[model samples]
Target: MSDIATAAGGFRYRLWRGLDPLPSGLPTGFAALDALLPSAGWPAGSVIEVITPAWGIGELRLFLPLMQRLSQQDQYAVWIAPPYTPYAPALTQAGVSVAGVVIVQPPQPQQTLWSMERLLRTGACGLAMAWPRQPTPRTTRRLQLAAQSGHSLGVLFRRQHAGPCRHTLPVALSLRLDAAENGLAIEVLKARGGGQLPAVTLVWP
Candidate 1:
């Protein structure tokens, strides 16, 4: 007879199921974008990968609303090794809480990733945004785990290459941003539970 046992005797062992319900997501401030996401918003407690052909394509604009919302929270919105200094007046005008924002500039690339991981695991960081020039698969995986442990939202901005990456790291959401006519176009490469979605364009009002 097989060694495997059945539950006929009311066995205490429980069968493994899927992940439990995720924490409710924070609104993306765009109805269309929110609707497209699996959680109907930026999935909380996970890493979000944003790939772009280059800067100045409304990458920061895409998250302005999210920053404003996070500003109202008790946790800090931290920026790690940003390419350019965040314009305070612009962020303020966007309704972001300047007081709740924190910027960190690490001296070296290695330190940048290290700082990002530390901030995300602090539990007091509401959002940890980083622009990692060359993040390995293992590095991304560690960041994802840190975000989950601290329940923080981590955003990784990567420069778009000529072709798809050889190895795509698993993330809660992966988005590619492109400049559209008077707006930004978003292509969802992968969304947990939501799968891939058609590109959505958001016209600037």
Candidate 2:
């Protein structure tokens, strides 16, 4: 299927499908979630949309292991305008380097997106994340393409629907997260190969 995202300039795109086998990824620590992900870990050099109701809904927990691993490997992990202050003790306990983390809070939303795109495009950060209100198809495409141009993983955490749009996001992975009894429930709305995948319910590591 094909779609068009209209902005000042329109972006036309098709569903993502890679002919090569999915690449290996950093382990998610949550075995169940890793098993369902395109790679054994999160997809590298791609934008992953994570939709959640709130900050503490196991979102950070879901990616902590990956972040820590990247930091240990000397890659910077960045958070652009995160919803809440990251507790240093908690992150340290998780084995993440506090020094390797960069938090940028742009005074304006437009600057925030711009900063995110630049960081992801440069691939200087191992991961770059942002929490923003709904973005236009054009904006999402820009960030998605920027991530593809670099090796960093770009993540957007939203509070709205994560379904397919008429002007679909060029994201390689999309997930909807909700608090579950044991931990969190993740619905894989899209994966590397471009299709609806299964839901993964797991406990916090």
Candidate 3:
């Protein structure tokens, strides 16, 4: 039966059998940031870490547009251990479909990662966001494999003490947020692509 499906339409049809088509790379609402990212967009089938010392550092700001874009395309977005209750008004204003948002709260850090991995591997979700205290190497490896297998986007929100991950995969970026006179200052501490490394100051209007 499976062979017949593949023979009829090739691997593309087989890969998407019984599932919605996978989303393309993230659509950065901001053109400049989009260009900086490899593939000119967020990496699919990979784990991306968003680290911050505290909440309200505009970390959500960086993620909101991406989430909104994904939801706009009728894809689902999952949030694990979100710091606060998301304001529905704000999300709606940003063009995200509040209906498609799924929030999962896991009691333990390990459980959070486990849930995220499971969801990402299900191929039923387009994106999964988790705030894990300190992820272990074993957990990260598992999550990495799940993301690749499902071709899902995983964003791991880490605290300051999460420390340096020793994973073999190279760190794509390390961003630190600070308060600037204008607004929030985002410093690209480390990135794979070389450049002047400008600090982006974003003032929410």
Candidate 4:
């Protein structure tokens, strides 16, 4: 059987019936933020869009925990064009195994997205994260399809002020991050199964 078929046949996939069910596991980056996320974990086989006006709006921090958690599950976490050379020490501090993290440098944002999609389609990595300079609705839809086909998690980080695309993404949720005095604030702009909700603030350790 193909890798995709194997993933779909796995117990986790069966439990959720192909689509990811809520209340999954998260990384160990932040305690407070994990509490606010649905199912206290990142949703597999879904696309999560993270937007921020500034680079240090705790966006990386938000994903650290999720990465750490996924790493512990013996799954690889792939990062494309990460803004900063992920401090392996910092990742270790966050309880993530640096060994399981794969960093890829793509020539352009579009290439990065394409690489991410290919990885998601392989069902190899547990999670894939990318920072795309420009993301269209159509591109996101393709990513969603890839995630579902491979039963993997894909996250897209985009600029905060960018306008919505003409098409709609197949993402389960679209979140915007804002820096707060205490930590980071998350605004759920759009969601699929559930409607939008007020912005939720979370503190980072």
Task: Score each candidate by Cα lDDT.
Answer: 0.83, 0.78, 0.70, 0.73
The better-scoring model by lDDT among 1 and 3 is 1
- Report the Cα lDDT for candidate 1: 0.83
Task: For candidate 2, give the lDDT of residue 76.
Answer: 91
Q: Write the per-residue lDDT of candidate 2 for residues 165-186, one digit (tens) a residue.
A: 5345667788888999969988
lDDT per residue as tens, model 4, 72-130: 78888998888878788888988999888999999766698889889988777888989
In candidate 2, position 21 carries an lDDT of 56
What is the lDDT, from 0 to 100, of the residue 10 in candidate 2?
26
On residues 1-205, what C-alpha lDDT tens digit does candidate 3 reach at each position? 5466447753422243454333345665556665444335666776777667777767777777888877767778999888788788998988889988999988775688889989989876788988876677677778878988888788887666555754432334456677667556766665544324676666665
**Colliding pairs, model 2:** none
* lDDT score at residue 122, model 4, on the 0-100 scale: 79
Off by over 4 Å in 1: 1-20
- Which regions of candidate 2 deviate over 4 angstroms? 1-24, 161-168
Question: Poorest 10 consecutive residues of model 2 by lDDT?
Answer: 6-15
- How do the predictions measure up, each by TM-score? 0.87, 0.83, 0.74, 0.78
State model 2's lDDT. Answer: 0.78
Q: Tell me the tens digit of each residue's lDDT in model 1 across 62-176.
A: 8888888888775689999999989999988998978989999888888887889888998889899999878777888889899989998999998889875456877789999
lDDT for model 4:
0.73
Let me know the TM-score candidate 3 reaches against the reference structure: 0.74
Which candidate order results from sorting by lDDT in descending order?
A: 1, 2, 4, 3
